[model samples]
Target: MTIRILLDTDIGPDCDDVGAVAVLHALEKLGEVRIAGMTHCTSSQWGAGCLDALNRFYGRGDIPIGTLTMPGFLDGDSGYAKYNKGITLGYPNRYQTEPAPDAVETMRKVLAEGEDGETVIVAIGPLINVMNLLESEGDLYSPLNGMQLVSAKVSMLIAMGGHFPAGKEWNFEMHPASAAYVVAKWPTPIVFSGFEIGAPIHTGRSLTADLPDTHPLRKAYEWYVGEGETRHSWDLTAVLYAARGHHPFWELESGTATVDAQTGANDWKHNPNGNHAYLKAITSPSLVAEVLDNLMTR
Candidate 1:
């Protein structure tokens, strides 16, 4: 059976996000998963545009794309706005555009209509959308929290957020309150792809080099890769794990993650809460290289 997936991404900040989307498209072609929706949680307008471009590139333009009402981080001008302008200038009408919807409504509708036990939520951005969904419409659904929603409607949540033993990841830090709420209350199995996972997997190398100039993935990468050259593929790793189930380098653990109220540190414990899945560590280099190579070529 194909896994139905909802991809929540903040695509533009780093080039790896585009790479992640590319990888996801490849997985869809292989029939490993069916993308139910794509939501953007970043402040980058360019990111949203990039996502639209990507969906159109793969001939999946009908896939719904939702943007966050507010930006997650404050990096100069909003990333979402910047991305929007950039992508509009670059691709023009290469993709469709839609206003951001109520995320809770979108998730509820998607999960309700999807095949039971075949859905997975792969989050590569902040937990705002998921958190909002839980806060507003969670009780209406079977699961009262994001975690519970996962356990009930999803097979698993392969998230590209949070740091494992350490606690300084950008996604977690961007919205600590939401992260705390989610990690503590979510019910389904979770596999966390953290900052460390992407460290060894650097971009601006083989993946871009191998792609032809007309390739959409290459165009997206070219826009984001600047300065120091290589960028982290944080989101792509989560996508890989979700599509492939197991990569050679990742080590999984069943545990509950508790966010420190003061420091925002995520402390994962092996208590039998029956509501957590923690990715303790990853075999960074091989997994990153393998995923990137596969995405660039395929």
Candidate 2:
């Protein structure tokens, strides 16, 4: 079955989100999955613009993109993004100088148009847009409320957030209320790639060595964390599970994951029928790094 994926990301702060996008595109080229759409939960025009530029690099400039009303950023560059800042390429992008569409509407339209129980939503950053999408009401496209729409259409929600076993991470810590609400009330099953799972497995070193100078991914990687430094495969791991599932790369720890009210630390209680599970890294980090390197270079 072709896994249809809708990606929600906060791509500017880290390079793995860029790597994850490259992985998803490579999978799509292999007919392993379909790119339904992408949304940004961070408020940076340059970030959205970079995503558009990357999509164009993959020859998918036409894919729908949306940005949240309240992005987690205020008024500064998120280290990278500004991909087209210093370079002068005849690149094809719409958001470099243009505005992005409303992300909630984009989510609604993408979900409403797809076949029920066939679409997978992978969120690799903060849960703002997903939370917004869940709490949103019906409009011109469907009669169902946000919760009802997700129940009818989405098959699964795979999120890369939380530092499981007890710790506060950026994704949940940024917005605890939304994270708590999503964890408790989301309609579909959730699989979290916690802080520990993706920390050891690294990628992006190959991109610095392999990809050409003119490539946008290479530029972004180089700009994000300097050349040749491998970034933790946090977002990439989540996208991998979304495309392939936990198999040779990782194992599943099934449980009910709850977020602490104030601290945002996560506690997972083992339960077989629980709607939640976390990825336990089983594949060698070096080996997984090789796999991601191959995908990143693609």
Which candidate leads the pack in TM-score?
Answer: 2
lDDT of 1 by residue, 102-197 (tens): 456667667766766778888887787777766653545444454445556777777777677656787777677877777766656677887877
Q: Each candidate's root-mean-square deviation in Å?
A: 3.4, 2.0
Q: All candidates' lDDT scores?
A: 0.68, 0.83
True lDDT of residue 237, candidate 2 = 88
Q: Report the lDDT tens digits of candidate 2 across residue range 7-35.
A: 99877777788889999999899898999
Error of 2 at 32 (Å): 0.8
Clashes of each: 16, 0
Q: What is the lDDT of residue 186 in candidate 1?
A: 63
In angstroms, give how far residue 125 of model 1 lies from its true place: 1.2
